[model samples]
Structure formats: structure tokens, C-alpha cells
Target chain A: MRFTIQRDQLMNSVQDVMKAISSRTTIPILTGMKVEATEYGVKLTGSDSDVTIESFIPVEEDGIVLVENIEPGSIVLQAKYFPDIVKKLPQQTVEIEVDDHFNVNIRSGSAEFHLNGQDAEEYPHLPQIQTNQSFEVPIDLLKDLIRQTVFAVSTSETRPILTGVNMKVESDDLYFIATDSHRLASRKIPMGGNVQPLSFENVVIPGKSLTELNKILDDSQETIEISVTENQILFRTKHLYFLSRLLDGNYPETSRLIPDEVKTTVYIDTKELLQSIDRASLLAKENRNSVVKLTTKENNRVEITSNSPEVGNVVEEVTAESLEGEDLKISFSAKYMMDALKVVDCEKVNIQFTGAMRPFLIRPNENDQILQLILPVRTY
Target chain B: MRFTIQRDQLMNSVQDVMKAISSRTTIPILTGMKVEATEYGVKLTGSDSDVTIESFIPVEEDGIVLVENIEPGSIVLQAKYFPDIVKKLPQQTVEIEVDDHFNVNIRSGSAEFHLNGQDAEEYPHLPQIQTNQSFEVPIDLLKDLIRQTVFAVSTSETRPILTGVNMKVESDDLYFIATDSHRLASRKIPMGGNVQPLSFENVVIPGKSLTELNKILDDSQETIEISVTENQILFRTKHLYFLSRLLDGNYPETSRLIPDEVKTTVYIDTKELLQSIDRASLLAKENRNSVVKLTTKENNRVEITSNSPEVGNVVEEVTAESLEGEDLKISFSAKYMMDALKVVDCEKVNIQFTGAMRPFLIRPNENDQILQLILPVRTY
Candidate 1:
């Protein structure tokens, strides 16, 4: 392949695909990125066994000359060293040429590098998914859903299916739920589109892949189209495509896990509660094995306290806007409570509970669609 | 004991002394900080047996009201938890009170903490150094000297003396040197006296203590006094007093290791050479062991190359400003060279050598007192 392209354009394409390049050297060729030139533009691909990313850069955009080529071919170059070199090149335009034997040469300014390239024929191919089973969602909403629920997924190896986020789609709404058996988080958003009549439920997507996809996705409001097959799932944008394998096991039914009614409801400013939890955590560290206690009396004031025999005790009286129902006292992991509160981007939050041992839900007062749940620790 | 202090002032003092606090719980009391309320002010002390730091906060500074007291006494509290609590307190001033049984109560707004405090009498006392053998030095100059020579100290415990920086003083000059078996660094500066005459020959200060001392010293031109004793050395400023034990052994004579004659010399831009060294290291990384080769010709161009059977080879030409004496080629650790160059605050440096097998020196053109020596690796 012989081509000349803008240095920044090539760097951006390399950065996107480089995330999939394997650092393990068992298969040396997998550490390389494949570059192919056709009549339309240049395409780059990188993959490990579990995930693959492919990005395409067109020859021209508006009046800007992005890529100029005289021949069309393909070659594989080391991804680890290629990006650093391209970023530090002295010239604005970079020239890449490959010989028939796949030896690649890159030149910019007075500096040149000769890298031993592998044959592109040895590269793995990407899986194809049927477009009929695909659905579209706004990128902002998708990233928000992932950030809210992915952290609650089980990281331990007890139950393999629990390590993934349950993604369910029905008619016009998408619901995401993740739980580690100890605590859970759930979020739902309404996205109207052409409905696929088949109901899809309990589809497990690994939390690892969802987190990585969230990081690489930019803050653009453009829609991302996703297609799912029996074994693989694909995310497609205008210029990029990402694919990952689906989990093999069945996800647990969490529909009955959420409590039906709340015994006590309290409305507190999110910032005030978060700060108090952080302070209460100082004493709670000694009890990394225990939970922080929260007490609400007949009035609107709530007291947060943590006690450890060796470190003494801390108490903070935080005034809430209002408190109702029978007076209640409960204890829960300070870390879990902090995690649930941070995802709530609102001024006020409503915390609802059924009992000391039952799961409690926290929701943004303004946006009630998103909910966070925590299992309270039973202490005598 | 009872006192009220500004949160920020208490936090700063706690953080500074915490550097000397022991993280290892061998002796439980060593992990805590002692706070004493005196007629003049309040003092905080933290010690780990190797080093001790005592910081004093007067009754009033610039009308900051750092401390106000109703009674005088002392107590020791766990250093790890006190700082975190004070930093998160909601009020501007924190009120602290000690009961008859030694239990302490800290209060700010609606937040209160009851800590288990240890008796102050159980804490180790700070050492007192006589001022008969003391001298004054600028804070910036002392920190610079430590940065220049400390990295070359031997990390192995086999040679305990070599793990410290050797300080020697004459009638009008001060010298500092450090060496591992493989490399050495030396710096010298002329001294003037508004002080007493000092003719100390050899005092070795532990490299680990110097590292911590340098971190706490600000880049100010104010003078601080350093006093030495048979087993300890003390650095005292207006508000802080630091004491460290001297390494127990005689330092090796390092003057014989420096070469007296120059065979070949070359001048290279500091930043230009550093970047090239970083690039050449990429190919070197793939070898059985990464090693880079350098060759200097009479034509003022230096060549850098590295090769691995599995990764191929890379070579680049870097143009030097000038060359003198015999043509030369030498190879050393890229890491050592990078470390040496990073501390040099000069634009152009002159690299001098006696022979290919002997240790070579890197020194700036304008100032020739400080020199960095690196031993060439025998790559058979």
C-alpha cells in the first residue's frame, strides 16, 4: 500500500483501533494493526480474541485533503510503536509505503523508520451481524446508562452471569440492571423508534466490555446502532465499528428483588449527604468489615454515625428537608452508599426503605426514572 | 487540655509532621503524633526512630488565630485518622478538649468525634543537637545538591556507607558525592562565612532521609542552620526542627574514580539527545536484553543503533555541535543516562572521556564543578 495522509487524521484513527491490540505476545501478529487502502479511503483494524475495533478515514472531507494515494493494498504494522512515532513526526503530512513482501516504510521530514511488517492475510476477520435485529440509541443516553449500572456488577467469580449487566428491551423503553448479590443498581430510559416485535430480556453483556465502550465513546449526541446475534454484538457509528462476544450463561431474574413498598422516606440534599458519608467513612475505615449507621427520628434531622472499638466513634447530624413514616434506623456499607449517591446528578434525592434487612432504593427527586439500591446490614 | 485552631493551619501542620510518622506498627505509639500546648504556642511531633519532625504554631500569626487556649497540656492521637477528620470538618475553627481520663473530644458545627488518646508521657522525646558544629546554607541550594547526588547512592544493604551522601567541608568550599559500584555523581560549591569556621572532613547522611527532607523543603532563598553530632544531624528553621541519624561507617574515597585527562569530547543539546535516546530505546526493548549502541565520527554526526533478531534494527543520525580529540564509541544504560540528564539545568552539556573502558563524565560547558559519571557496559 502506498498512501500519504494528514498526520493528525492518521493518529486519531490509530488511537481508536489501538485499544484492541493485545499486549500478550503469544500471537505476535495480533499486536499489529492492519492498514488497507481502497478507492474510497483507508481502513485500520485491531483485535484481541474478545474484542475488535475498526476505523475508516475517508480521502477527503469538504475541501480538506485527508488522504492521497496512488496504489491500493494492505499491510500490518506494529501498533505499539507506530502511534508514538506519528505523534512526534516533524512534518504535518506522513507518507506510508509497503513493498510486495510487506516491508513497511514511514517517512516524515528528514526522519525515516523501516518496520518489519507482517502479511495482512494472517489477520483475523470481523464477525458479521444481521441488520434486522439492530436498534439505535443516542450516545449520551447509552453512556449514562452504562456508568450508572456497570459499577454494581459482581467482580467476584462466584456467579459468572452476575459479572455482566442485564440489558432488556421492550417496545419503546430500555432497562439496565446489575447486581453483585449484595447491592444492585437499575436505570431505564424511553427511546422511541421503529419497534421490533420480538421481546428481548435477560441478555447479559459483560461489564468489562461495557465500561471500555463507554470510555472510547465521545460526548457526541449522534445515534449509535447496535446489532445482536446469537454469539456476538456489534456497535456501529458513521466511521467506526466495535464488536464483543456476549456472555454464555443465563442472567438471574431480578424483577422480584426490588421491594414493593417503602416503610420510611427521607428527602436530603445530595451534596450534604455525600459529604457526611465521606466524613463518617474516616471512622468507618477501621470497620471496613462493618457498615455506617443512619438514624432518622420523628423530625427532619438524620444522624450518621460509625463506631470501631479501637478508633472511637464519629457522629454527624445532617438536616434533611423532610422525613416521613415511622422513625427508622439502618446501617449499610459507606462505599456502596457513596457510589449510589454519586451517580445521582441532582440537587435532592429521596431514599426509601422497607426495613433494616431489606433492600432500599435511592432516586433523584427530579428524575425518578433512575434508581439505586443497597442492602442494609442487620446489626443488633 | 483545651484549644481551638483554624482547620487549615492544623491540617498543614498535621500533614508536615505525618511525613515522619511510622506506617509500620512495630511500636504502636510511633504511629501517632504528639500535640502539646505550651505557654508560647502549640507544637506537633512525629518520629519513626530514624527521623523526627517537630512543627511549632505560635499563638497568633498575621492575625490568623491559628490557636487559642484555656488550659495547657499534651496528648498523642493516631496520626492516620486525625488529618482526615480535620480536613473534612465543616467549621472554620475546630474545638478540641481532653477529659481527665485522656479521652479527647473534637467538635465543629454539628460534627463531633470522640477519639481514644494516648498519654503524652509515653511518646519518644526529640533529640537535642549542640550548635557548636553548625553552619548555614540556602534552602534552595541544599535541595539542589541533594537532587544532583542522591540518585547515584547504592540501594543494596551490603555497603551501608554507600547508601548515603558524603558531605565534606573545607575552609571555603563544600563538596557532596554519592556512588554505587556502577556509577558516581559529585558536586562542589564555594562557601563564605558570616558563620564560624568549619573544617569537617566526612559525614555520611542516609539517602532515604535526604529524599524526605528535600520533599519538604520549599524553593526559598532563606538560610537554615545545619548542626552535626557524632550520631545525629539536625536542620532547624524558624518554625520546624528536623533530626536524622548519621549512617554509621566511613565513606569511600571517590576522588580517585574521576578521570583527570580528556580523550574525546562532544557537545550536544540536552533535549535533542534525550528524545533520540527515548526513540532508540524502542528497538532495544525487544532484545534478549535491551542495549543501545552509539558511535561518534569526526564529521560531527553521532549514530545511534539497536537491534534484536526478532524485532529487526533501527539507526538514526544526530548532529552534534562540535567534536574534539580521538573518534570514540561508547554504550551505557539508557535509564542511567536519562536520569543524569534530567537534573542538569543547562542548555548544552559536554561529555568527556579518558578511554572507552574508563568512566566518562557529563558536565555542562559554562560550569564544570559538578560531574556525572557512567560506566560502560561490556556487551559481548
Candidate 2:
């Protein structure tokens, strides 16, 4: 492979692809990034077993020419050093040439680095799926959905399916749900779409892969096309392609875990409630699992308290904007609540609970589409 | 202590004293901050066995009145949580009242925190030294001297005294020297002293303690007093007193370590040299010691090269502004060169050496008083 490309453009594409490369991959070739020069542009691919990220540098962008070459070929270079050298190159354009034995020469200005590149043939082939099941959604909305639910996925390997985010689409609405058996988060968006009316279920993409893809996607209003096949799913944008393998098993039906009826509800200003929980967690954090107790009084005031035998206790009263139903008390992990509240960017939030011991739900005071459920602690 | 102090003032002093406290101290009490209220003001102290820092919140400063109290007492509180709580408190002036049993009530605005405090008497007292030998130096100069020499101090515990900065005061000059056996840095200041002045020999102070003190001291033109006793050294500013126990044992003779001979000499821009070394280190960092080679060609150019047998090699040339003496080649740790260059705040630096194998010296082209020495590696 031989080509000279703009330093900045190459660096940007390299970094995007690097997000999918894992240093701990057992297959050494998977740790390297594959670079291919085409007639149209230069493409860089970085992949582990679960996710693959491919970024393209167009032949010319705005007036800056990215690549100029007569030969088209491919080679794999170490992702760790490739990005660093490209970033630190002393010139506007970088020249890359690979010899017969895969010895790659990268030259810019007075600096030249020769990195031993691996044979592109040694790289495992990315799965090419032909089953045509595809849909489109706004990149910002996709990122928001991933951020709202991905953290709730279980990281444990015992039940591997729980480590992925479940996506369900029915006619005009798409739902994203993730649960770790301790907490559950679900978000639904009314994105009207149809190539053919689809009701696809049991689609689980690894939470870790989605997070990396989310970071690579620009939060613009640009649309992202997502295609799902029998084994692999692809999320493609204008200049990037992200592919993630599907989880083999069905995701647990989490609708039953969220309470259908509420015995008590309280509306609180999110920032004030977040601060109070933070302070209460200070003392509660002394324990292994930081848990804080919340009690709603008859006068719409909620008292937050946490205690540690060595560090004493902290109590704070935050007056809720509104409260109804039977006055109730509940205890839960402060970290889970804080994480849930942080993702829901709203002025006020309402928390609904069936009882002190059951899984309670927190959502925007006025919007009910985004739901977060947390199991209460048996702190009697 | 029963008093109300401004939140900002208390937070600043707490942060300053906390610098001296370490969470891993074997003596648990050293992790606590001692707070004492006197008729004049409140004093906060934190100490490890090696260094102690006491900050005084005066009764009044300029337009800000900090303390209001008639009763006097003292107590010790855990350094970890107190700073966080004080920073997060909701009011301008915080009221702190200590009960007979040392339970403390800290109230600010509508927020109240009750912390279990330890008896101040149990906290170790600051060292009392009859420091008749005292001199004053500018705070900016002291901070400058500390920064220039501290980075070269030995971190290994094999030779305890090499971990300290050696200070020697002659009739008109004060010198600071530090070395880790591989590299040495020395800085000198010409501060005129008394005619019947006390000639002081080399006294070593732990580099770690000086680093903490340097972080706390502001680079103002204010004069700070330095008083050295047999086993302790005190740096007293207007509202702060820094006490550090002298490292026991005789500091090695570092004067002989600095070579006066000359051979190959080169002048280079300090910033350019630093950036080049940073880039060179990236290639060498895969090796155990990260050694980079430098060779001055007869054609007035410097060649920088580093190679790993398995990872290939890199060679780059930089044109020297000026070069003299026999054409030379040397290899040294990139980290040592980077450290030495960081302390030399000059536009251009002149490097002098006896031969390729001997210890080389680097000094500012504008000022030769401050010198840095780096030991070369034997590259096979």
C-alpha cells in the first residue's frame, strides 16, 4: 500500500477506529488496525471479536486533499503506535508506503518512521450480512438512548445476555431496555419508520460496544442507518461504519419487573434532589454498597438520611414540589439513583413506588416515556 | 473550638494543611487535622512524621473578618471528609461548636453536620525549636529553588539521605543540590548576608516534604524566614508555619560529582530540545529503561535514534545551531534529559561534557549559575 494523506484527516480516522481495538485481545492481529487505500478514499478498520469500527478519509475534503496515490493495497499496523505517530507528524501531509515484506514507511517533513506492518491477509474477515432488515434514526437520539440505558447492563459473565442492551421495535415505536437484575432502565422514542412494517424482538447488542459506537458518532442531527441480520448488526453513518455481534439468547422481559401501579409519588427539583442524595451518600458511602434512606412525609417533605457507625450519620430534608398517595419510606443504592437521575435531563422528576420493598420507578415529572427502576433495600 | 468562620477562609486553610497529611500514614493521628482557636485566631495543622504544616486564619484580613469567638479550645477531625463537607456547605460563615465530649456541630445556612471529633491533645504537637539561626528569603525565589532541584532527588529508599535536597549557605550565596546518583541538579542564588554571618554546611531535607511545602507556598514577593535547628527546619511566613524534620545521616559529597572538564559542546533551543526528547522517548519507552542515542555528525547535525530489535528502529536528524569540539556520540535515559530540561527556564541551553562516557552538564546560555548534570548510558 502506498499513499500520502493529510495528517489531520488521517489522525481523525485512526482515532475513530481505535475505539474498537482492544489491547487485551488474545489474537495479536486484532490489536492492529487495517488500512486500505481505495480509488475513492482511505479506510481504517479496528476490530475485536465483539465490535468493529471503520472510518473513511475521503479523497478530498473542503479544499484539503486527503490522499493521492496510483496503487491500491492494504496492510495492518499497530493501532497503539500508528495513532501516536500520525498525531505527532511534523508536516501537513504524511506519506505511507508498504514494501513487499509489509515494511511500512511513514514520512512527514524531516521525520520518518518505519513500522513493521502485518500482512492484511492474516486479519480475520469481518462478517458480511446480507439479510435486509434496516432502519434509520437520528444520531443524537441513538446516543441519548444508549446513554440512558447502557449503564444498567450487567457486566458479570454468568448470564452473558444481560451484558447487552435489548432493542425492540413495534410498528412506529422503538424501545431500548437494559437491566442488571438490580436496576432496570428503558427508553422509548416515537420514530416513525418503515421499509416494511417491522416487529423485531430479542435483539441484544453488547453494552460496551454500543458505548464505544456512541462516542464515535457525532451528536449532530444526522441520520444513522442500522441493519440487523441473523448474527451481526451494522450501524452506518456518512463516513463511519460500526458493526457489533448479536447476543445469542433472549433478553428477560423486564416489563414485569417495573411496577404497574403506584402507592406513592413525589415530584422533586432534580438538581436539589441530586445534591441532597450526594450529601447523604457521603456517610452512606462508608459501607460496601452506599445506600441512603428516603422518607416522604405527609407535608410533601422528603427526608434523606445515611449512617455509618464510625462516621456518624447525615440527615437532610428536601421539600418536594408535589406529593400524593400514602406517605412511604424507601432505601436504595445512592449510586444507581444518581446515575439514573443524571441521564434524565429534566427540571423536575417524579418517583413512583408500589411499596417500600418492591422495585420503584423514577421518571420525568411530565414525560413518562423514559423509565428507571431500582430495587429497594430491605433496611427495616 | 466554638466559633464561626467564613467558609472560603476555612476551606483555603484546610486545603493548605491537608497537603501535609497522608492517608497511608502508619500513625493514624497523622491523618487527622488539628484545629485550635486562640484569643487571636484559629490555627489548623496537619502532619506526617516527616513534615508538618500549620495555617493560621487570622481574626481579620483586609475586608474579610473570619473568626468570632470568646472561648478557646481545640479538636482534631479526619482530614478526608472535613474538606469535602466544608467546600459543599451552603453559607458564607460556618458556625462550629464543640461540646464537652468533643462532638462537633458544624452549621452553615440551613445545613448542619455533626461529626465525631477526636481530642486535640491526642494530636501530635508542632516541633518547638529555639531557632536562633534564621534568615529571610523571597517566597518566589524559594519556590523557584525548590522546583529546579526537587525532581532529581532519589526516590529509592536504599540511601535515605539521597532522597533529600542538600542546602549549603556560604558568605553570600545559598545553594540547593539534589541527585538520584544517575542525574544531579543544582541551583544557586546570590542573597547578601550579614558580615558576621553564620557559614552553614550541607543540610539535607526530604524532597517529598519540600514538594508539599512548595505546593502550599504562593509565589509572592513576601519574605519567608528559614530557621534551622539541629534536627528540624522551619519555614515561617506571615500566616503559615512549615516544619520539616531533617533527614538523619550525612548527605553525600555531590560537589565532586559535577565535572569541570570540557569536550564536545552544543547549544540548542530549550523548547525544541524538550519536544524532540518527548517524541524520541515514545519510541524508546517500550524498552525497560527507555534509552535514546544522540550522535553529533562532523557536518554540524545531531542524529537521534532508538531501536528495539523486534519493533524496528527510528532515526531523525536535527540541525544544531552551533557545535564544537570532537564529533561525539552518547546515549542516555530520555526521562532524565526531560527532567533536566524542564527545570532550565531559558531560551537556549548550552551542554558541556568531558567525553561520551562522562557525566555531562547543561546550563542556560543566558545564565550559567544554575547547572544540571545527566549520566550517559553504555549502549552496546
Write one digit per residue (lDDT tens) for candidate 1, span A72-128: 999988887788878776679889899987777787754566788899999877676
In candidate 1, the second chain superimposes onto the true chain B with a TM-score of 0.94
Docking class of 1: medium
lDDT (0-100) at residue A221 of candidate 2?
97
lDDT of 1: 0.83
Q: A181-274 in candidate 2: lDDT tens per residue?
A: 9999999888665535443555999999899988888788989989988778899998999999989988888888878898998889998888
How many collisions between residues are there in candidate 1? 0
- The sequence of per-residue lDDT tens digits that candidate 2 reaches over residues B1-380 is 69889999999999999999999999898899999998888999999878889999988889668899637899898887889888877678898888999898788765667788899888876677685688888899999999999999999999999999998876577889999999999999887753125434668999998999899998899989998887888999999989999888988888898887788898877777776666666665566568888899866677877776666566777777798898788999889998888889997889887888999999988886689999999987
The DockQ figures for the candidates are 0.49, 0.60
lDDT of 1 by residue, B1-380 (tens): 99988888888888888889978957789999999987677899999989998888888898766788747899999887998999999888889988878898999988899999999999877678775878889999988889999999999999999999998875566888899868888887787663335435679999988888888788899988888888888988888888999999889888788889999888888777766666666655544335666788657987766655555555667788887888777777776777677777788888887777888889977896678998887766
Chain A TM-score of candidate 2 vs. true chain A: 0.96
lDDT of 1 at B308: 55
